[model samples]
Structures are given as C-alpha cells and as structure tokens.
Target: MESLLDISKAEKKNKLYDSITPNRFKRTIIKDWQLYVLCAPVIIYFLIFEFGPMYGVQLAFKDFIIGKGIWGSPWVGFKHFERFFTSYQFNIILRNTLVLSIYSLAAGFPFPVILAIMLNNIRGERFKKIVQTTTYAPHFISVVVFCGMINIFLSPSTGIVNFFIKQLRLEPIFFMGKASMFSHIFVWSDIWQNTGWAAIVYIAALSGINPELYEAAKIDGANKLKSIWHVDLPGIMPTIITLLIMRIGKILSLGFQKAYLLQTPLNIDASEIIATYTYKVGLLDAQYSYSTAIGLFNTVVNILLLIMANQLSKKFNDVSLW
Candidate 1:
C-alpha cells in the first residue's frame, strides 16, 4: 500500500511539472533561431540606446540640480505639473499642438494612400517608376535645405511666388511672418516631402494582393477601378490600420527642429507647440525639471490619444493596432 501511494504521488508531481513547463518559448527558438539571431543586434541597440535612458524620466518628478544629479535631486511631487497647468501659455501651446496635429492628420493621412493607389493603377511600369522616383526625390532633400527653399520661394523680394503674384497683379503673400500661413506651410511641406516615402509601404502591401482575385473580377467584367476598390483596398486595409495607429501614436510629438528653423518672430504665437515649448524651457532657459515634466505630459497625452483612436477604429472597422 505505501509503495503504491509513493508511485501515485510521483506521477502527480511529474504531471504538475509538465503542466507548468512552457513549450512556446522552446518552439519559438527551434523554429526561428535564424530570425532571432538577426534580431539580436536590434535588441542590443534598443537596450543600449532606448531603454538605457528611461531612468532619466525620474527628472520629471524632481527639482533637478546641476550638481545633484537625478538620484540626488529633491522630489517636488507635481510642482512642475501644477505650474504647467496654471501658466498662461499652457492653453495656447495645447491649442496649437492639437490644431496642427488635427489639420496635418486630416489632410496628410490620405495623401500617401491616394499616391499609392494611383501608382499601383499605372499599367506602364516605366512611367510608374519615373513618377515614383520624381516624387521620392524630395524626401532626400535635407530639412534645412527644404526650409531654406521655402523661405526663398516665399520671399517678398524677387521670389518666384512673388513674381507670380506680380503677374496676377495681386499682393505677394508673406508666408514666413504671417501667423495664419504657418500651419498651412508646415502641413503642405510635410505632405510634399513625405507622401512618396510613406506610399512605399502601402505599395508593398498592395503588391502582396493575390492575382487570382483580380482575374476573377475581370471574368465578371469588373473594370480596373472596381477591381482596385474591391480587391486591392481590402487586401491592404490591415496595413493601413497599422500605419494609422502609429501615426496617431506620434500625434503630439512634432519634432522641434523644422518648426524651430521655420519660426519667425511674427509667427511665434501660432508656431509654439509642445515640443518647441519644451526646448525653450529645457535648452534655452535651463529649466530641466520643468521641461521634463512638460515632456512627460505631452507623452501621456499622445499615448491616450493613440489608445482612444485605436479603440474607436477597432469598434467601427474591426481593425486595431493590438
């Protein structure tokens, strides 16, 4: 009886151990060893560069002294946040960031999709390649050079834009100094420079669509436009949703460099976004803690917006980032 009980207990222990052991990790390693090797460098890069600096986020909660460092700094629980909320410029900055992001999202989001659709529909490969190359060339132009070109072209004196206005017998619009024109210039320039490059992913997705679907549509006497609408768009909807999620994720993170370069004294009111505000507080004014708090706030808002957009998209379209 004791020997039989011992055997039963041992069998139960073995079964428990087996149940707790994970198989997915072992299977993943066996199936994807080569892929894992390729990803090792990227993992190391993120570890060294991205995750390495996450500790500095503590600066957001402290009154950081130059000599004291992050750990030695005195904690000022939410003081900076309070100041940020109460400051007169807070609303202005918030409004500017939202307005610019919304406008850019509305106008710029569909451009790459349209461009990809058009490029895919081009039956002549040579003409399509030429068009693609021409559109993509602008992406290689450095932002400094691009902004300079914008400034020169919009210059009231001897600029091509002004010259055109002169021909039309209308006043040359001042693009740089005008607060009203700042957002327009920023959004339009962003579209022109990025639309082609962004379309590359969509075009790649479109290529993966099965040829049989198009053939079937042809048999049914469906036209090119109809085939594209029914087959190609549906095939690439997943990629579209994924990219849209990413775009929404970065809605608040407008890079400071271009806006800073493009900024003029007259346009300051309209041009001041969260990123620029952080730059001014941190780099220019040496208020590191304050800037860190502001940066954290901006990040949280962006994340919330991304989550909300994803949830809404999932509910309506049955597509989401998750």
Candidate 2:
C-alpha cells in the first residue's frame, strides 16, 4: 500500500511539472520580449529571402514554363537529372569540381592553423601586428582585380615571372594558358588571399584557452612544441573539426566567379567546373529546368556529404554540428 502511494505521488509530481512548463515558458517570453524584438529583422529576412525561395525548387522536377507557372508545369519525373547524368560534359564537369575543391581543401586548410599557432607564439606584439596586417591585406583584394593581377604577372610577353625565365636563358611560359597550371594557380592564390583571415578564428579560439593549462604543461617540463601539440591543439580541436566538416560539406561548390574569371580557351578543359556549366546552361542557353535540376543535384550531394562528415566526426571525436 505504501509503495503504491509513493508511485502515485511521483506520477502526480510529473503531471504537475508538465502542467507548469507552459506557464513558465510564457513568463519567460513576456520577460524577454525585447530580445525577441531585436531578433525579428533577421528572422524576417531569412523567411523572406531564404525559405521563400525554396518554393521554386520544384522547377527541378517539372517542365518549367513561364506562361504555365510552377504549379501548372507538367512534372517530368527525373528526366532532367537523367539527361544530365548521360551528357558528355557530366564526367568532365564533375571531375573538375571535385578536383578543384579537394585540392583547395588539402592545400589551404592547414596554413591558417599553422599561421595562428605561429602568431600566438610570437613574443613581440609589434612584429606580430605587422605580419598580421601584411598577411591579411591580400584577402581584401577584389576577385576581379586579383585575376587581372594574375593575368598581368603570368603574361609571357610583359610579365615579371616570365622576365626572370628570360634572364635564365629559358623560354617564357604562358602560365595562365596552361591547363595543367590552372589548379595550382587557383589553389595557391586562394591560400595566399584567405589564410590570415581564416586564422583569425583559430587565434580567437587560442585566446579562450585557459592559461593555467600552459603553466601546468611548463611545470611538467613541456617545451613550446610539446605544449602546442598537447594543450593548444586539443583546446581548439572542436573548432577545427567543425570547420573541417563544413569544408567537406562544400566539396563540390567551388566559387564560380574566380573559376570563370580565370578560365581561358586553353585552360577550359581543366577549369570548366559545375558552377560555370550551370550558369552557361541556365542563363546563357535558357534551359531553366535543366539548370535547376543540376543545382538540386548539387545541393543533394552537399547535404549527403554534410551528414556523412557530421556522423564520422561524432563517431570518432564526439563532436558534431547536429
């Protein structure tokens, strides 16, 4: 009888707790109305510009006709997707996109971390600031301007790079015209442009690490490299993993502007990526449905990659975006 009464009391307490949760939530909303009001614009902006546009994604599956409208357009049931898969350019575009994205990730990801660590270890504040400014200045250069600079520097006739080659009694190579050199130029230039800006986040993470850990490592006779290997890396590991996952998720979404700007007839074989292909087919050729299908396919691949990366990270490191 006593046991039954205790169980009943526990059930009653749970019921009472559930009943009061809504009232508590309502009270919190009333108290925090100003905070919600401040966030309203951002919420409204996303709803209007982001979520609102998703309604048209159905064009990917339909024979989209401007006169007929999205709802009235006849559903084609994967016809565009099939056409894209069987197209001759499919393999080339996919290969170029993956190769460029992977190359960029592999070449560019570590530089920022290495830079942040080096900057954090600097003893002189003045030298650090100067180095930081010099490194970060490239990131502010406009993409178009950067591409123009690349063209100027790599020009066989009047370029500084070819000037050195001529001085060495060698033929001046047309760097921008070589299909083999496109990926290298794109990746290295991107690294140079973005490394310092990317390092800022790691620097912020390093700052938030507890100073006592470093002190303790020193007490244990750990040197600079050892401390960094142990305390510094481990402290900022979650940030690193999060960023890595994000990068992997965007493995196919190479920037269209840079690739398109850098593209030439000679380099087109290696530089014609999915983004440029989509633009040509969508706007240039006026194949709206086809382009939409390609875009949807790209999005689906990204989503899958994101989920896989998140899952793998969670399994190995117990860190995940979800």
Candidate 3:
C-alpha cells in the first residue's frame, strides 16, 4: 500500500512538472536548432512538392476550366467520381490493378527476406558482396532502359530467353505479346530488380542483433538454423512489419512507367492498370477532373489500408508504423 501511494505521488509530481513547463518536444527542437536547420531543405521540399500540391486536390471535385483556374472553378460535388465509378471500364481497371498489386506483393515480398537470410548465413564476405552488387545493380537501371531490355530479351524471334525454350524442344513464346504472361513477367522482373535493394534494411537489422544472444543460443546447444529461427528472425521482424505496412499503403500505387512501357495491344487486356488508365484519360484525353477523382479514390483506399494494417500489426505483434 505504501509502494502504491509512492507511485501515485510520483505520477502526480510528474504531471505537475509537465504542466508547469513548456513542451519537451519544442524544447528539444529549439536545442537542436542547427540539426533542424540542416533538415530545412528536406522539410521545404516536402512542403513544396508534396503537400503544396494538395491544394489542387479540390480540382477532383471541381470543373477545372483553364480560363476559370482552380480557385475560380465551379464545384460539381461527386459528378466526376460517380462517372468513374459507373463507367464500363471501372471494374476491369480495378480488377487489373488489384490483381497485379496483390500478385506482385505475394511474389515479391518474401524473396528479399529469404535472400537476406541466405546472404547473412554466408561465411564468405567477398562472395556475399559480389552477390549484393550484382543483385542491386538492376535497381539503378532506368525504367525505359529496363523495359527495352525486357522487350529485347523476351522477344520470340531474336531473344536469348526464347532460345533456351527452343533448346528444350518447346515453341519460342512471344512473352511480351501474351496477356497471360504479363503479370508473371511484371512480378518476376520487379522481384529481380528490387530483392537486393529491399533486403538491405533486413541485413542492417540482422547486423544490429546483439552478439551475446547468439552466444547464449550456442551455449544452449542451438544449431545455426535454430539460432536464426530463434534470434535472427525475431530481431528483424519489426523491420519486416514496418516495411509490410508501407508496402500495403502503396498496394494500389504501382509504377506507371513500367506498366505503360510493358503494355502492348495484345496485352492491353491484362496490363490496363489504374495508373495507365488515369494517364490516358487525364493527360491524353484532357479529362483532368475525372482522372483526379479516380486518383483521389485510390489514395483514400491506400490510407484506409495503411490504417488497417497498422492497427492489425499493433494488435497482434505490438509492431506498427505508428
């Protein structure tokens, strides 16, 4: 009872102290003003390039006449949004977008983790560095160049990939031209390009694990596999959860350039994602308000998914983006 009284008194004291003082956060910021000054450019960049443009999001609801301008534009409420929702292309585009996103997420998410674990297990540092360099190099390739390379490498008539198929007594397949092959090609290529880069954080997390934990495991007679299962995974699971939440937040916002570049008349049925559709309608057809509405809808879904994922993570594992 005395210990409980002492705890209550301590809490009251802390509350009194907090109430009498300015915010600790503000004080810390003021104390670290120089660091904040150095961070000013990044803050300003986001304020300008990221949040600044949000003012025009109202254009999604307004009839954005060139002459009238954004401020002068007349509001149409949900006219554009309703139009997009009720359009013939709505279901098709949404399905294609969701399918591609989910497919890519399922296939691409785990390979990096597996790669990181494998790479961590490697004893030879030189070979590991070489593997990391080779895997990470493709991520630096420009979208246009990467798409071009995909086209050339997967070409039925001239590509080396098809040559291997011919060697197995199979027909030379026109992979880029086939609708069925579109998702496979897109997902696999994305995995290949990003796995190494994505594993970097996991590798860092693994590196940060306390050596004493491994020593303990060894003292317990735990084998290498058991040590990894018991120590390594739990250490990096936070990173995995955080990254998963972020990726969930971007589930709909697939790269427009790669999908657009990969698209062909033959594969349009499968490759017509929301981004490409938005591009065609917004820029090419000059339906700005309608496309903006669609984009806003996509963003709203992402926000909701992010919240849901964060909540679930926190509830189940005490890990979340928040």
Best lDDT goes to which candidate? 2
Provide TM-scores for the models.
0.84, 0.88, 0.86
Put down candidate 3 lDDT per residue, 100-130, tens digits, no spaces.
9999999999998889989988799999999
Better of 2 and 3 by lDDT: 2
Which residue pairs collide in model 1, if any? Answer: none
Give the alpha carbon lDDT tens digit for every residue of 1-322 in model 1.
Answer: 9999999999988766765567845765778899999999999999989997688888899999989888999998999999999999999888888888889989999999989999888889999999899989899999999999999988988689999998999988888989999999999999999999989999999988888999999999999999988988999888888888888888899888788889999999989999999999999999999999999998898899899989988898898877
Ranking by TM-score: 2, 3, 1
Q: Report, for every candidate in turn, its global Cα lDDT versus the true structure.
A: 0.90, 0.94, 0.92
Locate the minimum summed-lDDT window of 10 residues in model 3: 19-28
Best by TM-score: 2
- After TM-score superposition, what is the CA distance of residue 18 in candidate 3 from its true location, in Å? 11
Worst 10 residues of 1 by lDDT: 19-28
